[model samples]
Target: MSPNVNRLRVIALYKELHRLGRDYPDRSYDFNGRMRRMFEKNRHLTDPEDIEKAIQFGEYIKSETLALYSLKKYRALKRMYPSDDKH
Candidate 1:
């Protein structure tokens, strides 16, 4: 991908992740703050491969965040309605 395209993808991913961070599983962890710092640290890359790798890593983080949220909901449901087999 061209450098311009990579920049756009990174910006889009950053924005989406920041938005998703509002519903992050742990509010005490400063998810958005940490994400901003990490992205700032990696903002100077010029290599296409490195940028691509960073984008992929960002995608991975996004998926993991979603998984954590899903797991949280699952735990809530489990607590709300207990299974009867144990009794």
Candidate 2:
């Protein structure tokens, strides 16, 4: 699977966890750490397939379609250039 897919999964997990009121900082940190490890392990792969993954993970699940579209656009940009690329 692509890095983006993995990231999307992690993001979804975090979101779900937050929505369910699971441990906030801990869950987010754990997911982020896992994502980092995966990136480091897959250093040979391309940057990441962020766009497709973000879309698949419902990055634009807002109540309004406009908000969803805006989220999609924003996520598209994010997928192209994620902020947490320390790996």
Candidate 3:
């Protein structure tokens, strides 16, 4: 992939991570800080393969975070409307 495309992907991931962090049940500040630091720490990577791998990893994390958020929301909903069929 072109360098421009790779850079854009990284930027998008960073923005998405920050946006998702806002709704994190844990400390948003800490989550955002860790996300920022993870990217910053890897900012120096020059190898195309390594950069691709990192981007893939970021995507995986994003998916996992979304799943976790969904599960949390589901649990909250269940608590609010618990089933009457308690056995």
Candidate 1 local distance difference test against the native: 0.91
Cα-based lDDT at residue 81, candidate 3 = 82
How many angstroms is residue 13 displaced in model 1 relative to the true structure, after the best TM-score fit?
Answer: 0.6
**Of candidates 3 and 1, the better by lDDT:** 3
Q: Model 2 over residues 13-55: C-alpha lDDT tens digits?
A: 4555335333223445564455445445544534456545543
What residue runs in model 3 are displaced by over 4 Å at the alpha carbon?
Answer: none
**Winner by lDDT:** 3
* Residue 86 in candidate 1, Cα distance off native in Å: 6.3
Which number leads on TM-score? 3
Candidate 2: misplaced stretches above 4 Å? 22-87
- Ranking the candidates on TM-score from highest down gives 3, 1, 2
lDDT of 1 at 41: 90
- Candidate 1 on 1-87: residue-level lDDT in tens? 888899889999999999989988777999999999989999998888888888999999999988888899999999999689976
For residues 25-63, could you state the per-residue lDDT of candidate 3 as single tens digits?
Answer: 888458888988899999999999999999999999899
Worst 10 residues of 1 by lDDT: 18-27
Q: Each prediction's TM-score against the native?
A: 0.91, 0.26, 0.92
lDDT for 67 in candidate 2 is 54
Error of 2 at 23 (Å): 11
